[model samples]
Target: MLPRLIDEHWRRIGFTQRPKLAAIKHLCREVDLLHPQVDDNGRRPDNVEYPWTGASGSAEVPAHWKFPLMSRLHDPSGKLLLKAAVGLTRNPAMFIR
Candidate 1:
């Protein structure tokens, strides 16, 4: 989900002018893993959107879990991404070229 959204965002901005912060890529991957698609074999059922049974037979709700990305937001790369996002929102025309 996030991976595709990020790709579209960059596509709109154009590759040459897109911010170089590597954290955007990492964040997109992490976000995608959070909402994994269950394969036809029913494997990889874990996702952050719905409840799934753990290996120990306990029902786990992803909303109750603490994702690492929340903490990463305070780190350098995350800060860069946040800043760039805010900048884009403030002056969207700056990146339209």
Candidate 2:
């Protein structure tokens, strides 16, 4: 379910390449600019788990999950990301229904 959503969103936005772990880290930093409160403890509501934890050990886990959502939202193109996020929060039943 989640992978599909990600693939579709990326495709729609013309992101021809999937992000590497390093790129993801960069995106997280960018998103953090918009949401300083979101950390990378893997405790955020929808946090992305650090994929290279085995290679980097526990030190690589993010403090928050905002990167996944924020990576999309922080794009300078438009506010669709924000709108989608707001929609999810405003209508919980949308997914549950």
Candidate 3:
């Protein structure tokens, strides 16, 4: 699932100096594995339907349609990190001392 998405995203996007494959590989590794499954009950999506139209629409309009891989994984606790890899706060009081 992750590999295929990275491949597609790679084609759509380009890097300036570096090869896209390397960038995609690095990006994939950087993504948070916060929700291995989207559901709280640990359910993975079985059937994935991609967008029929290109560029015209991005968001899902109705229950019948969905954006299968639109979002990138962010920290579930909302503890986004700084450029130095020092953790910054998105949500406070989510940690134990």
User: Number of the top candidate by TM-score?
Assistant: 1
Off by over 4 Å in 3: 8-19, 33-97
The positional error of residue 12 in candidate 3, measured at the CA in angstroms, is: 11
Error of 3 at 21 (Å): 2.4
lDDT of 1 by residue, 8-86 (tens): 5677767755544466788655555676573224655567788888778999788886776789878766765676567
1 or 3, greater by TM-score: 1
lDDT tens digits, residues 1-97, model 3?
3334434433455634322444344334434322333332433222233222324444433235443333322332112122112211333222212
**Lowest summed lDDT window (length 10), candidate 2:** 45-54
Using TM-score, rank the candidates from best to worst.
1, 2, 3
List per-candidate RMSD values in Å.
5.5, 11.0, 16.2
Q: In model 2, what lDDT does residue 46 have?
A: 31
> Better model by TM-score, 1 or 2?
1
lDDT of each: 0.64, 0.44, 0.33
Model 1 spans > 4 angstroms off: 1-23, 36-46
- For model 2, residues 1-97, the per-residue Cα lDDT tens digits are 3223333556666778743334444443545544435545644323244332433244444463334454454453224434444655777444342
